[model samples]
Target: MTKINVETLTYTQLAKVFDHAILKPEQTTKDVEQGCKLAIKYDAKSVCVKPCDVKQAADILKGSSVLVGTVISFPHGNSPTTAKVAEALQAVEDGAIELDVVINIGHLKSGLYDECQKELEAIIKTCKAKRSDVIFKIIFENAYLSKDEIVQACKIAEAAGAEFVKTSTGFASSGATYDDIELMRASVSDHIQVKASGGIKSLDQVITFLQKGATRCGSSSTDKILEEFKQKNSA
Candidate 1:
């Protein structure tokens, strides 16, 4: 694998790779607005906020190129498939440009790969049909999976036509690790993008994951990470 020097990435480039996430239900509209402002200020790719705030985020980011993203099935993937699909559709209708849906972990654990695949496919199909421009990301919550299971999940995600396979939901026991990122990268063909979410708390961690093949990042600490980069570069 080619080595990536995190220190060398430009501030703008780093910003483009971040998905400023605010998943907490308690987050107020002001909090969501602050997140949108930070994303726009830094030119981040998108701001991942709760589904309820998609329209608000979209309105805040209007005329800007930043995309709005929200979660379906959220931190837990135990929601019924129909509910997940409904959430995805509703979010898009509310102006979400990206939908990150959690894969059903219990189904996967039970070896019901087909059921899991169908659920993801249903949501993907609905999103695509409703709005061809919307992007779909499937979160696998890798903390609970074995290496082989992770690989299988990626394969299923690819088969179901998800644009990205994300690791963890930040509510899981663990977050994205170098090994897990590499494993995911190796598992899927180059056509699919990999997003690293969960415990990324610093610029170094983000750079490490990007080097390991993560195309995007999901973290609530996007502002802190970008601040660190600016300070380091200024020094």
Candidate 2:
């Protein structure tokens, strides 16, 4: 991964690194609307919303540079492979160009590598069938796994043809850490990207992760972080 030079970074370049999240269970439709507007205003790379909000986000973001993204089997990866496949297809059909699916954490922790890989393949295949360009990101929920398991999850995601491997679901016990990001970057080939999510609330944190090798970050603190960047860069 190329190093990110903080001194030369632009607001547009940094904003594009964020997948602004609005996935909280209790957030209302009004919140989704407002969130989408904020994302559009910032020209964020995408707005990651709850599965149910995909269509609404898509509608509001249509024709804008921001793309619609949604999560499947989110927060928990306990759903069956068939169910996950159906969810992915629905999300894509609803105008979600990106899908972030949680891996079956239990399966990986129990040494069920084949099961995990098969599930990822099935969902990826189903989504690609609907739209060939749908981006697939496999979320590891790294807080639940050991360091070795995190490495294993990275390999599994790469093998399953996922475009990115993510750190958490943002509801986990913890989120992305510097060590985990470096380890994930080292585990995968250069073509595969890493995304750091959860608990990131400042520009300094975002820049640190980008320099460590993350291509994207999931955060709800988009306005705060970006405003802080403006204050720093404008001085």
RMSD of each: 1.2, 0.9
lDDT by residue (tens digit), candidate 2, 1-235: 5567667798899999989999999999999999999999988999999999999999999999998999999988999998899988999989999999999999999999988998999999877987999999999999999999999999999999899999999898899998999999999999999999999999889999998999999999998999998888888
| Model 2: worst 10 consecutive residues (lDDT sum) | 1-10
lDDT of 1 at 233: 84
Quote each prediction's TM-score. Answer: 0.96, 0.98
Relative to the unseen true structure, what is the C-alpha lDDT of residue 70 in candidate 1, on a scale of 0 to 100? 93
Quote model 1's TM-score: 0.96
What CA RMSD would candidate 2 show?
0.9
lDDT of each: 0.90, 0.93
In lDDT terms, how accurate is model 1? 0.90
> What digit string (tens of lDDT, one per residue) describes model 1 on residues 172-231?
789899999999999899989999998999888988898999989998888889899889
Model 2 compared with the native: what TM-score? 0.98
Candidate 2: stretches off by over 4 Å? none
